[model samples]
Target: MKKKLLVFLLIGVLVFSMAGCGNNAEKPKSDIKVAMVTDEGGVHDQSFNQSAWEGLKKAEKDFGIKVSYVESQQDADFAPNFETLLDAGNDLIWGIGYKLSDALLDAATNNPDQLYAIVDFSYGDKTPDNVVGVVFKAEQSSFLVGYIAGKMTETNKVGFVGGTAGDVIWGFDYGFQAGVQYAAKELGKEIEILNQYAESFSDVSKGKAIATQMYQQGADIIFHASGDTGNGVIEAAKEQDKWAIGVDRDQNYLAPDNVLTSAMKRVDVGVYNVVKDLVEDNFPGGQTVVYGLEEGAVGIAPTSDKHVPKEILEEVKELEKKIIDGEIEVPYNEETFKEFMKTL
Candidate 1:
């Protein structure tokens, strides 16, 4: 009788333990794999691709999920990289640049049920139900940095170096110039703003040459929206003892003294938030998600204090708030910018 009772108790304990284990099962997202196909500049560009990878890494750490990426060496590699990540069973795949728009459309169309994301490109009403577009209001942040350059430039001349000619880069270009124009009017200084486009995001030498020429042309500070090409801009700034404004990331570490400030685009935060939304089963498919100053997705780098004065930093903060509050409207393209120029 005693032995039977002991055996019954043991069985009861085992049943309870099994029930608890079942109740404590992990969420489905734990097993979901995520991957990205980098742009031509690759993950080491220290800008777009790099920030996206950093976001995935943070997602892996926070969610206990696997994350990976495939770097494309050229335009031809884009389609193949997408295929590889998709074949590897990635539950969510991201295309990291506007250049991947065509490839993303094709891939999303072929795999109608497959979940996909693209940064910097939006398909509008034609977007597939399984795809999401992550875009940023880069103009807002560029304007802040441009204001900073306008405040700091002692030479009364500034410049902009760009990688490509597109609506996206246009925002960076016009916003910066508008800010400079605003500051010039305020300070009663006739500031000359120079501009250049290397037509390639990866050509470091061309970027350096542009910066050097701008510096020689009496422009003491220059802002760049070029990816890795901007690295050369910073290098030239350091060598020439001038200032260069970085893009997409806090590039102060590259040249602590020469880097005046960076137009911080939080690509990492954007990617991570999208991953979290997908894991929570709230993936916003067929939508163009715009991250802007209001979303805390873009701003001047925190390292700006290393060079920018307190007064200018405070003004930048106020300007960002005004923009978010609908008081200060930053222009995005040629038409809007022409109008904004009139106001400044």
Candidate 2:
């Protein structure tokens, strides 16, 4: 009877120990799925789409959210890809370019329960309650880099190659031109800007052709906002031993010797913030969030070489402060650009 009692007590202790261990074990994390649909530039464009994807990847790491993406090969693919993501049970979906604005709106309308965010788009008063618009004051940063190109160029001729003539792309174009003009005036020099649009974000050959032509026309540095197409411009700059400025990402590594700097748009931050908000139940829908130099959403990448002088960088920083302080207004459209040109 004594031995039986001892065995029974041991069994009870074992059961209690197992119960305590079970109570102390970590609970399984709830699944929060987030997905993105890239624009025509796709994820590997090393530009806007790539930046958005980087933000999604970061969210997955930090928040333990399941993340996936669908690449849009053309304009027609946008809506379909959004559907694919929705069908796959994504709790939050993002469209990663201004081109996806309409598609995102349509999707948001049809799927009112799902949360959506779009980068580089402004819906103004038309924003849906289920959608969030993320835009950047790219012109503000483009101006700074344009100043860099203006001050660094020995030929007094700079060039801009753009992917499209849309409003968002035009922001980069107008801002850069304005910055160049501002720098030229400050330096007491006359500079001519050669600008053109390739009309497509993925046409590498066309971008290269445009850059080569500009360089041949005595342009010492070419700034391209042509997405993957800008990759071609970089190659042309390398081949001709000229300088190339990248857009949206720090492309110095693309051709470290030839790339002077890059006009950066913090798409990653925008995407990450929207996703974080959704995760935290504080999503700011039915609104447009504009990030600018003041918000550290746009700027120029660090110069990879000694081509840009320290004084020029310092001057650019001063200009950045002025813009952020509202002492200087960067042009973001054709009308504003024309007005800005008058000041120059």
Best by TM-score: 1
Residue 332 lDDT, candidate 1, scale 0-100: 86
Off by over 4 Å in 1: 1-27
Which one wins on lDDT? 1
| Candidate 2 per-residue C-alpha lDDT over 106-172 given as tens digits, one digit per residue, 9 for 90 to 100 | 9999999999988888889999999989999999889988988888899999999999899999999
Model 1 per-residue lDDT tens digits across residues 158-277? 999999899889989988987888778889888899999989888899999999999999999999998988888998999999999999999999999999999988999989999999
Q: Candidate 2: which stretches are off by over 4 Å?
A: 1-30, 304-306
CA-only RMSD, every prediction: 3.6, 5.3
- Cα distance off (Å), candidate 2, residue 240: 0.5
- Taking all chains together, each candidate's TM-score versus the true structure is 0.92, 0.90
Count backbone overlaps in model 1: 0
Candidate 2 minimal-lDDT segment of 10 residues = 22-31
- What local lDDT score does residue 37 receive in model 2, on the 0 to 100 scale? 93
Worst lDDT 10-window in candidate 1: 22-31
